[model samples]
Target: MDFQLIFLSVPLIFIAYKLFNRLRFKLPPGPRPLPVFGNLYDIKPVLVRCFTEWSQQYGPIFSVYLGSHLNVVVNNAALAKEVLKDNDQQLANRNRTKTIEKFSKNGMDLIWSDYGPHYVKVRKLCTLELFSAKRLDALRPIREDEVTSMVESIFKDCSAPENKGKALMLREYLGMMAFLHITRLTFGKRFMNNEGIIDGQGQELKGILNDAIKLGTKKSLAEYLPWFRFLFKAENEALAEHDSRADHFTKKIMEEHTIARKKTGDTKNHFVDALLTLQKQYDLSQDTIIGLLWDMISAGMDTTTITVEWAMAELVRNPRVQKKIQEELDQVVGTERLMTESDISNLPYLQCVIKECFRMHPPTPLMLPHKANANVKIGGYDIPKGATVSVNVWALARDPAVWKDPLEFRPERFFEMDVDMKGTDYRLLPFGSGRRICPGAQLAINLVTSMVGHMLHNFTWTPPAGVRVEDIDMMEQPGTVTYMKTPLEAVPTPRLAAHLFRRVAVGNV
Candidate 1:
C-alpha cells in the first residue's frame, strides 16, 4: 500500500481495536458483531422478523450496533412499559441523525426533534387545536364528505366503459382520500382538484415528501461512518430536490393563508393560524411554522395510508373475521347514513378490528430511535449515555408470552384482554408509547376506522383474478415503516350480491 494509505489505515485499525477493547458495554444478549459494523447485516432481511427471532434466543432485552450507533431492543412487554412509560422522562429524547435532522426542515419539526421546550410547545398545540374532541367532531363532516366522494369515485372507476368491469386500485384510492382529509385539517384547504383528482399542487407535494421520506428512512452507508460522507452524495441530491418541492408546497399554503388572514385579520380557528399566533407570542421563526405544518403532512400521510391498506389486506384474507365485523356494524349502525367518532364505543368489534391491525402490521415496527440522556439500567443490563435505543414494538406485539397465537391476526384477542394503544399498555403499542408516541394517534385512529368501516359496509372485497387467498404476498418490505412489497389489489363487489361470489371467494366480515 502507499504511504498515505498505510497511515490512514493504521488509525482506523487502532480505533477499531480501541472501540472493541476500551469501550466496555455490559449489554443484553445479541448476535456478535464485526469490528466496526455491528448487527446491521443481521437486520437486513426483514428486520422485525429477524429481531423477533433474536429476542427468542437473547431474552427480552438486547443490544446491537449499527456502526458506531447503539440500539437497545426491548422484547418483553413489561420492560417495554418500564422504558416507554414509567421511565419516559429519562428516555423521551430522540437521537438526531444527519438524514432525519435534514429531513425535518432543519429540526423545526417535533417528530424528529429532541424532547425539549420547543417539542413540548408543539405537542401541546397539536393536542389542543387538532386532537381535541371538539376539533375532531368539527372534522367529522370532512371525513364523511371525503368518504362519500371516495365511494362515488370508486364506482365510476370500476364501472368505466374501458375497464371491462375490472376492480379499481382500492389501496391508492384510500391513501389519496386519507391524505386529502389530513391535508385539509392541517392547512385548512384541499390540495386536490374540485373532482378529487390530485391537482398539480397535490402531485408536487406528494412526490417531494414521498421521496424525502424514502431517502430519510434508507440505511445510508454514510450514516454509519461520518468520514464516508461522499458515499451518499446521490441520495443527498435526491433528498434536496424533494426537500425543495416540499418547501415550495408549504410556502404556497403559507402565502395564501397569510393573505387571507391579513384580509380577515381573524386567525381564531385554523391549526396553522394558531401556530402563526404562537410564532409571534413565543418569538419563533416563520420557518418554524412552515416546518411544523410540513411535519404533520409527512408524518400523517404515510402511516395512515399503510394502516388502511393493511387493514383491508387482512379483511380480504380472513372472510370469517370480515363477516363478524360487518355483523357488528350492521347491528350497531343499521343502515346509518354516516359514521362518526361517537359510533366507536357502540361498535366494539370494529374497534377490535382496528386494534388487531395495529398489532399485526404496525406502521413502524421499530419506533423512532430514542437516545439515553444518561447511563441507565434496563432489565439488569447497563446502557451508557448516548446509546441509540429502539424498542422492538413488532417483536413485543407478537411475543407469545404477551398474546396467544402471536403470529395470527385475531381481533378477539383485544376483546379477551384490556390492552390499549395508549402508552400504558405495552402489549399493543402501534402508535408507540410515552412522550414520543404519535401525537396524531387520536386523529389517525378516527380516520382509519371511519374509512375502513364505510368501505366494508358499502362493498365486499375479494382477491384479484387468479390470486388465491393462500397466495397473497404477505412478505413485507424494509423501511422505517414496513409495508407489503405489493399493494393489495382486490375486486370490491357490493355485499348485497354475496351469493354470486360464493363459488369464487369469501371476504372477512
Candidate 2:
C-alpha cells in the first residue's frame, strides 16, 4: 500500500470507530435502522406486530428512530411500570404525529393535551361529568336501550325466512350499533334508525366524521420524513376542508343543544346536557367543547365496535368457546328473558372470553403514542428527551413468558388467573394505565360486557358452511385501531323469543 493512502486510512478508521461507539453505547438496543428511512420499512402495515417482532430480537425495551424521531417501544410489563407508573407525571405528555397534531388544534382536547393543569382540570371535569362510575351507571339505560335496538334489528333480520341461518355482516352491524349508541348518548336521540342506516342531516354528519377519521389515520410521508413536507401539502389541504366542514356540523349540534337545554332548564342528563352544564361551570371555550365532543364520538364509537367485533370473530373462529359462552348465558340468563348488565357478574365464562379478546386484540393497541418530556432511563438504557414512547400493549399481552401459549385463543387461561384489565395489572392493560389511562374504561367495560352477553344470550352463532374454524381469516387492517382485515360474517340463529328483544311502549328502544 502507498504510504499516503495508509496515512489517510488511519483518520477515517478513527472517525468510524468513534461514531459506532457513540451509537452503540448511547442509544438503547434495537433493530439496526436504515440511514434515512429509519425503522419505517421494518414496521410497515402494523406497528404493534412489528414492534412485538423486534422485542424478540432486541430486549423488551428498545429504541427505534421512526424516521428522524426516536421511538422507544416498551413491551415489558415490568419495565412498563417504570414509564406508566414510576414516572407518569414526567412522561405524561402526549407525543403526537403531524397527522394527529393537525386535527388536535394545538392540543385543544383532553386526550392530546400535555401534562399540565389544563389537562388535569379537563380530565377531572370530563371524568366526573360524563364517565364517572355513578355517571355511567345512571346512563346505563342509554347503552341498554341501544343494545336492545340492535338485538331487535338482528332478530327481525333473522326472523325473515330467506335470511334464516344466513351469514350476517357482524362487524357492520356492531359499528352501526356503536354509532347509534354514541349518538343517542351524546344527543339524546338516534340519528341512525334500528335498520343501521342514518337519516338526512345525520347522513351528512356521518360522512364528515367518517372522512375525518379516514384522513386522520391515513399515514402521510411527511409524518416520518420531515424533508418530504411538500408530499403532504395536498393531504393537509383536504384535511383542513374536512375539519372546517366537520366543525360547522359540530357547532350546529352545540347550538341546538344550547337552545334545547335553555328551554328545558338544563335538566337533561345525557352527555351533551352534562357538557353544557360543565361548559358554563368550567368556562370552557366552544372550540374545546367541540374537540372534546369529537374525542367522545370518535373514540367511543369506533373502538367499541372494533373490540366487540374482535370478540365475536374470535368466538366464531372457535366454536368450542362459543358453545361454552352460550351455555353460561343459558344458565345465568335464562331463555325467557334477555341478558342484562347485572347478569354479567353471574357469567364468569363470558367475562373470560371478553378478557381474552382484550388481551388478544386490544382496541387501541399502541395506547395513543406518548412523548417523553425529559431524559429518562429504562431497562438499563437511556431514552433521550423528546423521544416518542408507546407501550406495545399488543406485544405485552402476547409475551410467551407472561402468557402461556400466547397466540392461542384460550379464555380458560384468564379463568385460571385473577389478573385485572383496568390497567391495574400491567400484564393486560387493555385500557391503559397511569394518569392518562382511558377515562371511559368503566363505560366501555359495561357496554362491551353487556353487549356480548346480550348477543350470545339472544343468538347461536356459527361460521358460514364449509369454512373451517382454523381457516377463518384472522388478518388485521392497521389504522387508528387494528380491525380485522375482513368483516366477520357469521350465521346468527335466534335462540330467544322475539318478544324479549322489544321493550315496553313507554321505554326507549
State the C-alpha lDDT per candidate. 0.75, 0.80
Give the poorly placed runs of model 1, Cα more than 4 Å off: 1-23, 161-165, 266-270, 496-509
Query: Candidate 1 lDDT, tens digit per residue, 380-455?
Result: 8777778777888888888777689987878998879888786668887888888988877887888888878877
The most accurate candidate by lDDT is: 2
TM-score per prediction, in order, is 0.90, 0.92
> Please, what are the lDDT tens digits per residue for candidate 2 over residues 1-509?
69688556654654565366457557678877665567777776877787788888887888886765778889989988988998787788987766666567668888898999878888988877878777777777778877887788788887899997678888767887898778777766677554556788689778987897778677777788665577678887887788788778878877787897688665466676677778878877777777787788878998899899999988888879988998888888778987778888888889899999999999888888777888777777777677778898998898888999999999999768889999789999889999999988888888999888888888888888787877778877888588888888888888877779783211322
Query: Worst ten-residue run, lDDT, model 2?
Result: 500-509
Clashes of each: 7, 1
lDDT of 1 at 210: 71
